[model samples]
Target: MNYFNYKRRLSSETRIGDIPLGGTNPIRIQSMTNTNTNDTEASAEQVIRIVEAGADYVRLTAQGVREAENLRNIKEVVRSKGYKTPLIADIHFNPRAAEAAARIVEKVRINPGNFVDRVKTFENFEYTDEEYALEIEKIRAKLIPLLNICKEHKTAIRIGVNHGSLSDRIMSRYGDTPEGMVESCMEFLRICVEEGFSDIVISMKTSNTVVMSQAVRLLVQCMDKEGLSFPLHLGVTEAGDGEDGRIKSAVGIGSLLADGLGDTIRVSLSEDPEYEIPVARKLVAYIKERENHPEIVAEAYAGYSPFDTSRRETYAVENIGGENQPTVISDRSNGNFELNSHFLPDYIYVGKELPLAAPRAIPSIIDVEGWKNGKNTYPLFTSVNYKEIKGNAATIKFLRLSYAELTEEVLSLLKEDTTIVVILTTSHVNGVGEQRAFIHTLMNNNCKTPVVFNRGYKENETEDLQIKAAADFGTLFLDGFGNGIMLQNEGSIALKSIDAYMFGILQASRVRTSKTEYISCPSCGRTLFDLQTTVALVKEATSHLKHLKIGVMGCIVNGPGEMADADYGYVGAEKGKISLYKKKNLIEKNIPSGEAVQRLVQLIKDNGDWVEPDNN
Candidate 1:
C-alpha cells in the first residue's frame, strides 16, 4: 500500500514560508512563544529555541498593534541568527494586529469566535434567518481588510476554532457544541473563499478530547459536502502536563491521524514549548509507520457517526459497569504470579494450561478446559462451552468471544445466562472498530451483556507500546463505550508500566480519577517563572491527593480561562508574584513566588481539601 494513499484523505497543498503542507509533505510540528510579543529579543530567542527543538513553525501572540509592529524586528533578529522557521501571528479580537502581522509573518491565525465579534458580549436573542444573513455580511465586511492583506502578502491563514471560545451568536444558535465549533470556522472559511484566498489551514481544538476529535471530523464532513478540502491542523487545546497530557493528546490527535486526517499536529503540553516537539515527532512517526502497514485501512461503519458518541447501555456485572468505575484486568498468566504493589490490577486472568496457582487474596479469571472448581477465582469459559458451564454457580462467569467469529447463537446465550460477562477479543485489521461493531450488534439486538474490551500487542519499546494501546482503548472510552479493559503485551516491558498506562488512559478519558489532575500550560516567553520547576514542585507536594484537580498556569492568558474547570488554580500575576484561585473565584492575590506553593497548600487545608500525603 502506498503510505499516502492508505486510509488518508488528501487535501490541497498550501505553502507557509519555505515549507508546504498537505499533499505528500510530512505532518509538521508547531509551538507558540509565550513571551510578550513586544519584547523582540526575548520573543526571537524563544522562537530560535523552539525551532532548534524541532518545531517546523513558531507562533507569537499579537494582542495589539504594538506587538504586531514588533514582529518585523523579531523576524529580522531570528533570521539574522540563521533560523528560517516559519513565523505565525496568533490573533484574537485584533483585526488590525492581524493585518499588521500578516505583512511580516508567514502565517496569521484568527479565532473566528472573536475575530469580528467586536462587542465581546454574550446575548440570547432570536434572529430571523434574514437577520442572520445580514450579520454574516457585516462580520465579513470587518474581516475583508485582513483577508486582503493576507492575499497580497501570500500569508497563509488558519481559522482556529476553540470549543470554549465560541461566540455568543454561535452559542445561541448551536449551543456550544462540536457543530457550533465547525460552523464558527466554516463561516470564516466561506468568506475567505469568496475573497479568492485559498492558502488556508483550519483547526478545531478543545480541552475535551472527544469534542476535539468529533469537531474535527464534523469540520471535514461539512467541508467535504461543499467540496472543500482545506488542510487540517490538529491539537487538543489545554491538555495538561506529564503522563496524562501525553495520553490525552495521543487519544485525540492520534485517533484522527489513524484515520488519515491531520496535516500537522501540536501536542499542547503544560511544559516548555521545546518539550512538545519530541512527542509530536513520535506521534507523527507512528502515523507514518501505520500508513505503510497493511492493517491501516479499515472500513468505518456508516451507521456509527464519528462525530457523536453513544455509550452502549450495560447492566452491572459485579462492580464492572452501571454505577461502578471501569475495571482493569491484567494478564498475569505466563507463570508469573508475583504481584507488584505498584501494578495492582482489579483482576488477573490465567490460561487453562498454566501450572501456576492463583493467589488467595487476588481475584482471578481462570480459563478451564473442563468444569473444575478453582480457589479464589472464577471459571472463564468459551462461547461454545458457555451452556455446558451455565450451572457452575460462580458469582461471576466470563465468556470470551472472538470478534471475527461471533455468531448470533452465541449471543443468544446471554438471554439464558445473565451472569455471563463477555470479553470481546479481535484479530482483525481494525481491532477497535471490530470490537465496537460487536457492541453495536449487541445493542441492535437489545442484548445488554456487559462487554470487556481486550487487545494484544507485541511491541518491545514501552513508550511506543503505551501509545498504541492507549490509542486503541482510549478512543472507545471517549465514546462512553466499554465496561472494562484487558491488555496483553508479549514484550518484556514492566508490568507496572502497563498498569500505570491503563489507569492513565482511564483517568485521561475522564472515566475515573486516581491522582491529582494538573492543568498546566506550555510555558512561553510570557511566563513569569520557571514553569517546569514550579510544576514539579507542586506535583511533588500534591501527588497523593486523589481526585483533586490543580491548575498550574504560567500566565494569565490560559490560567483563569483554561483552569476554570479545575478545583483550584495557581496562576502567575507578574515577576515574583502569584495568584491563587478556588474554582474561578480569586481567593488570594500577589503572593511572593517563593511562598505561593505553601500558601496553596494552606488554602487547600482551609477549604478542607487537603489530606496528608501517604508518605510525604
Candidate 2:
C-alpha cells in the first residue's frame, strides 16, 4: 500500500448476476434485508426497496434449508418486478443451506468461522500439528461440497469471517486476533483454489473499527503473498444506528476505501435496511472522488507500520500528546457558538478575540495579533510567524502548518520547541494522504512535536459532512497518528453538530471515548426478536453509562462472537426470550422479553457498572 499516493488495489473480477465487481469496475454498494425470508412478498419488496435506494446488490439471511428454499420464491418475485439487481443469500453454520442457496441466488455468503467448525466453547484446548492438519482436512471436506455447487451454478461465494466468532480450532491456534481472522478466511480460500473454484469474494467484519480496518489490510497482504487477488468486501458489523452508526461505518469502510482496497462495501446499521444504502453511497462517492488525484510524491516512512495500531512515539506537550487521550478543538472562528457541557471541546479557536462570557477553564486559541497572554489562552501562528516565539517561556503554543510548509527550518524549530503543538491541515484533493505525508515527514526527521489534524468541509448536509470528515480524520487516527482533531465546516451545520461529530470521529477511531458505545447488529431473517425497538429500549435505559461498552445483538448467530469486546450483552436466545452476557460469559438466560431491559439494568448494577443518568 502506498502511504502517500491514492491508487486502487487491482483484484480479479468476480461476476454476481449482471454486475461484476473488482478489477477496473466501479466500487459497488450493497445492503441486506431484514424481512423474513419465508415471506416471499415482504422479502422481495424489501429487496426492491434496497435496490431502488441505490444498492447494486441485496442480501437476505438463510439460516436453514427452509429459508434457503424460500430464496427461490423471493428471487422469482423480484425478477418479475423488472429488477435485475443481484440477490445474495447470507448463510451461517449450515452447509446444506449454503448448498441450497447457491442454486438459487447470485451469491452465497458463508461464514468460514462457523461453516464447518463446531460452535465456539471458549475453552483453552491445544492442537498438535497433526490435529491441526486433520481439522483443515475436515473443513476442506465440508467446503468442497459447497464449492462444487457454486461452480455448477456459477454462483460467487464470500468467505466472510466475523471477529467475534472464530472457531475454537482457530482460537486455540491463533487466538482471537486479526491474524487469526486472516487465517480463518485464507483457510477456506486455499481450499477453493485447490478445487479450481475462483468465483470468490472475501470480507473481515467486526464492530471495532481499528480491528476491522487492520484485519482487512492484513488479509490483502496475506492474499498478495499467496498470489491471490480476490475482490474484497468491507463493513463494520453491528455499527449501531443514527449518527453513531454512520460515523463508525465510514471510519472503518472509508479508511480501507481511501487505501484503494475494497471492491464492494456495505454500511451496516441498526436502522431499516434501505436507509443504509444512502450512507454507503455517500461514503463510496466521497472516496471515489480521490481517484486520479494529483500525485503525492513521497516515500513510505520506515518508522511507521500500516499493519500496527500503536500510537506514534512523541514526547508529551502538557495534555496534547504522549499519554493524553486525543483532544478535541472546536472551530468557532466564525463567531456562531454554543458551549455544550456534556460535549465540551478541550479548546475553542476564536479568530481574534476571547469570548467575554465563555468559561476560561477550557482554553481558547487566538490569532497571533490577538495574543494578550490571557489565562489558559494560546496563540495560533503560521509557519512564517512561529519564529517570533523562538525563546518565549509560554507553557504551550499552537503553530498551524500545512504539508508544503514542513521545510528544514521548520523541522529544526519543531525539534527545539517542547511547548509547540502543531496544527496540521491540507488543501490537496487527496487530503488524507497529504496530511499523512506531513506526519511521516515529522517521524522521518526525528521531530517529536505533537501534531493535531485539522480539516474543513463545505458540505451542507449533515450526513455528507459526517461521512467526509470521518473519512479524513478517521484515516489518520486509525493509523495511530494525530494528537487531537480540529473540524471546521462552512455549511449551515450547527456548531453543536460539528462538536458532536468531532467527538464521534474520535470515539469511532477508538482514540477517545466521550459517550456510550453500542455494538448493535442490523436485523436479519434469523433475528428472533424486533431488533430496532429493542435497541431503542436498551439505549433509553443505559445511554447514561458513558464508560460501558454494550452489545445488543439480534440472535445467537451474531451474539457472543460479534460482541466479544463488549462489556455487557443483550442477545436474543429464542422467540420472546433474551439472554444477558458479561464479556462473552452468559449470566442470565431465557428472561421474558418484557422484563429484559430492567433485568439488564439490574445486572449492570450488580456488576458495579451502572450509573444514574444526569437529568440536567
Give me candidate 1's TM-score against the actual structure: 0.87
TM-score, predicted candidate 2 vs. hidden true structure: 0.99
> Model 1 residue 587 lDDT?
93
Q: Identify the runs in model 1 with alpha carbons over 4 angstroms from their true place.
A: 1-6, 34-54, 77-83, 116-138, 168-176, 225-227, 289-304, 334-343, 352-359, 370-375, 382-388
Clashing pairs in 2: 164-561
TM-score of each: 0.87, 0.99
Give the candidate number with the greatest lDDT: 2
Model 2 per-residue lDDT tens digits across residues 531-563: 999999999999989999999999998799887
| lDDT of residue 357 for candidate 1 | 67
Cα lDDT listed for each candidate = 0.80, 0.91
